[model samples]
Target: MKADTVGQEAADGLLPVLRELCRGAGADGSLPLTPRALHAAREAWGAAALLRLSGIARVLGEVRLSRRAVFHYSNPDCPCCRHKLTPNERAFLSLVRAGIAGQKTAATGAALILTEGGPVEPARNAALALRGVWSAGPV
Candidate 1:
C-alpha cells in the first residue's frame, strides 16, 4: 500500500493497480521474477482483484493524455456498469486532479504516469472509459 489508498488495509488490494501500471507501460510481464510475485499476490488476493482491473489502464491513459480538465466534467452514466466509484478511486482521482492543477499534494510523480504519446501513440486507441469515469476506473 502507498499509505494513500483509502479504505483498504494493505497493499494486497493494489495488485490490480500495479498490473495496470505495468500494462500501460507496455510490459509483457514475462520476466522470470514476475511470476513468483504474481502467483503469490494472486493467491493472496484471488480472482476478483485481477478481474476488476478491466479497462483501467486504457481509461487512465486517456486521462493522462487529456488536454482538458477531466474533473471539470460530469461522469457520464453507463447502464452497463454495475459499479460506482470506490473510496480508493475517489481518493486517487482527487490526487490526480490536484496534481494536474499544480497543487502540492502527496501524489508526486503523477506527471510521469501521464506520459506523452500515450493516447495518440497507437492509432487513436484511446478508450471511451474516460467518459464514464473522470477520476478513476473499476479497480
Candidate 2:
C-alpha cells in the first residue's frame, strides 16, 4: 500500500492490525466487514478500529474509495492506452462511477480505503500495536 494514500501513520499501523486479524480469522479464512458491522465496530471500538478494518477491506477488494477530491474519468477504458478495461478494472471503474453519482451507499460511510489489492496475504507479526488503539476511544 502507498503511504501517501492514507497518510504515513495509518499505512504503517494498518498492516500489523491486518496481520493480527488474519491470524484470528474464522474457518473460512476470510475477513468480511459489512457496512453495518463497520459502523457498529466504530461505535464500540472507536474510529481507529474502523480505519484498520477499512484498510483490510480495501485489501480484500470488497470496497473501492476514490482518494481524489474530484471525479475525472468518463470512459471505463484506459485513458492513455485507449484499450478496453479488464474485468477488475471495469469493477473499479463502476465503483468510481457509483461513487461519483452518489449511488454507492458506502460513499457516505467513514471507511477510507487506502490501497488497492485483489487478494491480500498479510505477513504475520509477533506484536500488535493496534490492540490498544481499538479500545482507546480515538486517535
Candidate 3:
C-alpha cells in the first residue's frame, strides 16, 4: 500500500491503544496532558508500535512529539516541500516531544511541521522549552 494509506491505517489502529494507555495512566481524558503523562503516553505509543502490534508503529516511528500532547494542522503535507508527510515523518515528530507535557497557552494546539531527514532532536527540544501561552482572559 501507499505510505500515506499505511500511515492513516496505522494511526487509526494506534488511537485505541493510545486511549487505553491514557486511561491506564490516569489521564484526565478531558483536560490537556501533563508533561509526565505525555511522556508516558509517547513511550507507550512507541512501544506499541515497536512491538509490531499495529501498523501505526511503523508510521509512528517517524513522527515527532511536540511539547503539547496534541498537534492541530490543516495540511498533512510537508510545509517546506508541500509533499505529503510520510508516516515516518509523523512518527519521528511524535517522539520529539516525548519529554514535554503541559497545557499550552499561546496556541490552542500545536502545528507539527513536516521536515525531511532523521529525527531533529534540537528542534524538538526547543519546542519543549516553550511555555504554553494560555488563551486570553477569563473563560
Number of the top lDDT candidate: 1
lDDT of 1 by residue, 77-103 (tens): 333221334333444444444433334
TM, every model: 0.28, 0.24, 0.22
lDDT of 2 by residue, 24-43 (tens): 43444455665544544455
Q: What is the per-residue lDDT of model 3 for residues 1-139, given as tens digits with 9 covering 90 to 100?
A: 1234333423433333333333333223232333533453355444433232222222222232323343222132345422344443344334322323323321112223432333444444343432121111110
Query: What would the C-alpha RMSD of candidate 3 be, to one decimal place?
Result: 15.3
Ranking by lDDT: 1, 2, 3
Model 2 stretches with alpha carbons more than 4 Å out: 1-11, 32-46, 61-139
- What lDDT score belongs to each candidate, Candidate 1 first? 0.35, 0.33, 0.32
TM-score order of candidates, top first: 1, 2, 3
Best by TM-score: 1
Model 2, position 7, has a per-residue lDDT of: 25
* Backbone clashes (count) for model 1: 1
